[model samples]
Each structure stands twice: as C-alpha cells, then as structure tokens.
Target: MIEKKITLVPIGDIDDSLLEYISQSIKTTFNLNTHLIPCQDLIGCVPEPVFGGRYNSTTLLKQFHECLPGKIFKLVAITDLDLYSPIFSCFFGEAQLGGCCALISLHRLGQEYYGLVEDKALFLSRCEKEVIHEISHLFGLLHCSDNNCIMYPSNNIIDTDVKSSSFCPSCNSLIERALV
Candidate 1:
C-alpha cells in the first residue's frame, strides 16, 4: 500500500513562508508527513479566466486531482483568489469530502478583505484553521456542531475567528480512527 501523506499544492504565486507554516502545522496536527510542491507544479491547475475572475472551487479541485501523487496522499491546493462552489456563493475552501483532493482560498482570510487593516498573523491563523477543516473532511469527518471546533462551518469571519485551530474532542477521535 502507498504511504499516506499530505501534499501542499499552490495554485499560483503563493508565499513560500505561508506554505511552509501550513505544512508544519499539518504535520504536527495529523502526525502525517507533508510535502510542499512548488508553485510552478500547480500553475497548470490555475483555472482559465472566469467571468468575474473568481475561480470555481470544484473546477480547481478537479485540476488538483489530475496532479495527485501516485502514493495515497491528500492534496490541498492553496490560492489567493476568491472561490465559489455551485452550492455556495463563496466559501473559504472546498473539499471532495472523503476524497483525496481539497482547495482553500486565502482571498477571504485576511482582515483587509473586510476593509480592515491587514493582519498577517490573524490571516495565517484563519488559513491554518481552514486547512485543517478541509483535510479533516478528506479524512471522512463531517461538519461539527461545536462552534469552537475547526470542523464547524464558518459563515463569516467572526465564525472563523471564534473557532480554535484544534479539533474538538469527538472530531479528534474521528481523525484518530481515520488515521488507523
């Protein structure tokens, strides 16, 4: 069997530091090895210009699927553009939900997006939470009711900020089982 791992795919010009930070967090959180594929590897995954420039999250997810590594691995594609799914107007991220691919957008994670001053620290925190939430779903975990859990859906920035980056106890247990 192929070793299970997590691979970070950048949809475009993403900061290396940010990707490294998220990679480290994923390693520590799920106790799985993480790989960072440079931006060039995913430039092809960048969707063609959409009507308003907002890429369809599902389309990007499919693109990422084509680039998945041969080994059993979870692919998390990060981007700076806004993203939307057919089901929602716009979402922080979208996942195949128990499949091998997921996508997260950094567009809405920063304070500046809301007309506030830019907060890099807070933006990184929010990005980390979204990454964890989406990966957990790829592991077959669903949304949680606990408001403070990372798995809880964030309807707005406040919802994202209110939640902890760590998973709730039950969600953690589910993750543990999935790992096994």
Candidate 2:
C-alpha cells in the first residue's frame, strides 16, 4: 500500500520559515509525514478579489484541488492573502470538511495587519492554530464546542490566540479513529 502523507503548498511568496513551522507542527499533531511543495504562482492564476481585497476561499479550494498532486492523503495551501466565504465576511481560513484540501491565509493573523506592533511569536502561534484547525476539518472533524480545542472555530484573532494548538481529548479520539 502507498504511504499517505500530508502536503503543504505555498500559494505565493510565503516565507519559508512559516511553511517549515506549519509542516513540522502538522507532522507532530497528526503523526503523519508532511511534504512541503515549492512556492506556487497562484496569486495571478486565482480569480481576482471580489471586494475589500478578499479572495473567495471556496473558489480557492477548488483551484487547490485541481493544481495539487492527487497521491497525498491531504493538502493544505498557505497564503498571505485575505480570504472570505459566502457565509462569513472574512475568516482566518477554510477547509473542505471531510475532504482532502484545505486553505489558510495570514493576512489578518498578523498583529501588524491591524496596525499594531509586529509580534513574531504571536503571529506564528495564530498560524499554527489556524493550520491545525483547517487540517482537522479535512480529517472529518467539526467545530468543537470546547473553546480550548484546536478544532474550535476561531472567529477572530482573540479566539485564535485563546485556543491551544493541540486537540482536546474528545477531538483527539476522533482524529485517531479517522486516521484508521
């Protein structure tokens, strides 16, 4: 049987360190090997932003499915662009629930985005949380009620900062079962 692994695709000029941190975090969280693809020129290829410079995340997920390799067990695309869905005005990320493709954007995660001082540690923490949250959805997990859980939906940076990067007990069990 072919060994399935999680793949990380950088949508544009994403920083290497951010990708590396996310790749390592996913490997540790899911106990699965991770493959980081080279930066892709998706900014120009994807549809232009509709309004307020936000790209529709659902559309991007479809593009991700078309462009990403099929052999991987899961695919997560990281971008610095802002993202949104029809249901929400703007969000940190979006995933294909119970599906293999997920996408995350760092546009709003950074403190600098809000005109505050840059905090690298805080920014990375938010990124990790969002990455794990989106990937968990790919594994058939839902928005957990436990606010501390990684599977919890983060409506804003405060919610993201409040949640831990690890899964809560109940969510962890579900993840284990899904892995089987």
Which tens-of-lDDT digit does each residue in 1-180 have in candidate 1? 766888887876898899889988898899888887765665455477574877888887887777555564788889888887877544799998899988899999989889999999999999999999999999999989999998999878899999999888999899999988
- TM-score to true structure, per model: 0.91, 0.92
The per-prediction tally of clashing pairs is: 0, 0
lDDT of 2 by residue, 1-180 (tens): 557788788876888898889888888888788877764533336568886988899988887777655465788888888888997544889989999888899899989888999999999999989888998899899988988999878887888888899889999999999888
Over all chains combined, what TM-score does candidate 1 have? 0.91
What is model 1's C-alpha RMSD?
1.8
lDDT of each: 0.85, 0.83
Q: What lDDT, from 0 to 1, does candidate 2 have?
A: 0.83
